[model samples]
Target: MAVDLENPSNYLTTRVRQAVNWGRKYSLWPLPFGVACCAIEFMSTVSSYNDISRFGAELVRFSPRQSDLMIIAGTISYKQAPILKTIYAQMAEPRWVIAMGACASSGGFYNNYSTLQGADRVIPVDMYVAGCPPTPENLLYALTQIQERVEREGLVPAAVRHAGRVQV
Candidate 1:
């Protein structure tokens, strides 16, 4: 089963899983759930300077139905938790979530009764970008990490995949 490295046919001999993962990794349409200060940073990430479009996530769809990635980029107050859950539930299957910023990831300095502590309390998060308000570059780096995860693991629904894990 020795294969020639220089052969052109070898280039096309990718497995079905790899092919599917490749397509899913690049076509992630993000649903930016911006709610607070971190929202501003998320906006900057998509702006011309950061240009998230370069990674195939330029189409920031507001409607959950049209998106596959949910970027929760701010604080999630108790009142807003239900709304966030509703939106996450509405997103199409094979959806992924990113907790973008300290606020969204763990309530940041707003460790009060109103804030939910973390976006993961409402929906499963696949990637978490840290910082009170993470820079656009940080957001971009997180996106690339997510891309790498998708490429390696394929698009399995987080709930189904992590059902065995204990929720903390």
Candidate 2:
């Protein structure tokens, strides 16, 4: 069944799966990969006014092993691709990635040879927030989308990386 994030009350599912997803959606530990102008906007999302904590993602973890979501909020150079992949590899199962800007999503205006056209070239992106520097509200919206997807997927982890690099 399709579970709408805005109104899950209308949907029904097995109690166990619902319970698990309930806990998971309310507790998403995000790891911020900030490296450019968009990083500043991302910080604003965690500020008192925007308060990312309200979404249950207040615990911004630096360790990949401890985080379930990764917010890539800047341009990714080829030099940084390996590092990004390494951190992603370290994250546990059911991990999510949000490309939080034009730069992170498609390298923005840095269409140079050194810059990676998109983080998706090196990692799988679960969500993409457009704009040279997307507003904090957009990031928060992306977060909600992640929660929605998590709830919809139920007990099954969808971000599993298979040998063939399939994103299911």
Best by TM-score: 1
Instruction: For candidate 2, give the lDDT of residue 102.
Output: 94
Model 1 poorest ten-residue lDDT run: 159-168
Kindly provide the TM-score of model 2 when superposed on the true structure, using C-alpha atoms: 0.86
The per-prediction tally of clashing pairs is 0, 0
Model 2: runs farther than 4 Å from truth? 1-14, 158-168
Deviation from native of the Cα of residue 75 in model 2, angstroms = 0.2
Model 1 scores what on Cα lDDT?
0.87
* After superposition, candidate 1 runs with Cα above 4 Å error: 1-11, 164-168
Question: How many Å off is the CA of 50 in candidate 2?
Answer: 0.5
Q: What tens digits encode model 1's per-residue C-alpha lDDT throughout 1-168?
A: 886988866665689999999988888999999998989988888889889999999999999999989999889999998899889889888888899998899889988989998888768888899888999999888888989989998878777766756252
Q: What is the C-alpha lDDT of each candidate?
A: 0.87, 0.87
Pairs clashing in candidate 1? Answer: none
